[model samples]
Target: MDEMPALDKMIIYLDQLAISQIFKIKTGTYPSEAPHHAFWTEVTNLLQQGVLLQQVLCPASDIHRDESMVFTRGDELTLTHEMLGGDTSFRSSSEIEGDQVWAYLRGFVSGKEPILDLSVDSILDGHRNEWLSRLHISAAMDWTGIAKDVRDRREMSADNMVPLYERWRADPKTSFKSVLKTELESFGSSRVTAYLHFAEMARRGLGSIPNQFVE
Candidate 1:
């Protein structure tokens, strides 16, 4: 059988867990007034941090009637599989050993934690702050010159790699999958190994793993 593409694999992994399921939010006017940006930003952060499996918004609805203060009701919130977009599809890694690769990707992109907690507001707030911090760090690191350092350390001569490297560098919006594939090919690393390394890095940054391979 032909091996599935890396991105397809990620999507399949997410689909298996039904993580694409849509959920709803029910709250009082105050909570409902929370901006969509705040809600989504929090959800994405949680997913990235492995806090939530999936993050989706609830369907829009009109107010039916105003109810008087009822302690029993106290703003009901329900999560269901009815809010996801009709055309939404997973795109990341294939399922491997029961791990939802797409779920991981969703978390990566959304910056949300994996474990879902009922304290939506608090979780969202934390994620927002974390997201801002990450942005700041990334912005600062943009001038690190690490890419040049790594290129210089590589054994392969730049003369031979000029063409390909130039093509990649010239592209303003290079896709991550394409970049991963290119780097793996250039470094003579197997796709699986490269992906494993990337996953580990996502879980634990550089130097977290002592060795790349284990006996």
Candidate 2:
């Protein structure tokens, strides 16, 4: 079983990306050199805005009301070059690209080996306490529900089970048509068609899943 749901993983990735961007904006530098205090300050400031806070956090359900801390009080935030993207020359600058962020996100949800050390204790968890409070809430939403359905209902075979569209969509370097065609040939028409249909639903809005099923 997938330990962390795909949609939840995606939300966490997006939240982390937003946090990194906000950190860069406030400090006039990327997160690599940012202090823990500065990072938390931006998070606190962001939470004060009602709409944007909702957009940024995207809490799914009542679990957001939970007051539990995701990271222990003694936990110290470390700033390291490795965590900040020193491994690959794909991005020479400190700024984390959208494509790189998405690739890491995809790798995370798919259980692929970590490329950038995204362990919960790392910078990704700076908002951990707040995010966990709202984590359960967002997981119950329609978008996440669709992801759950896809995970549960997708075929077991490697040919049909791999989320070709999702993986390709997350990677900027990959060609969608090429991947889809390859998947179609390997998985056959019936299975590939279902994947296409699900991808379409995911595109327009995952909230549309119920309507698509009804029709």
User: Who wins the lDDT comparison?
Assistant: 2
> Roughly what TM-score does model 1 have, to 2 decimal places?
0.17
Quickly count the clashes in candidate 1: 29
Please, what are the lDDT tens digits per residue for candidate 2 over residues 100-210? 555666888999964774443232323422323322211111233244444344334445545765686688798768876887687556644775797788888856567
Per-residue lDDT tens digits for candidate 1, residues 75-187, read 22111211221122222123221254444556778999644333322212122112112121111113123444444544355576687677778995888689878777866
Q: Which ten residues in a row have the lowest lDDT in candidate 1?
A: 60-69
| TM-score list, all predictions | 0.17, 0.19
Tell me the deviation in Å of residue 2 in model 2.
44
Report clash pairs, candidate 2. Answer: 60-137, 60-138, 61-137, 64-133
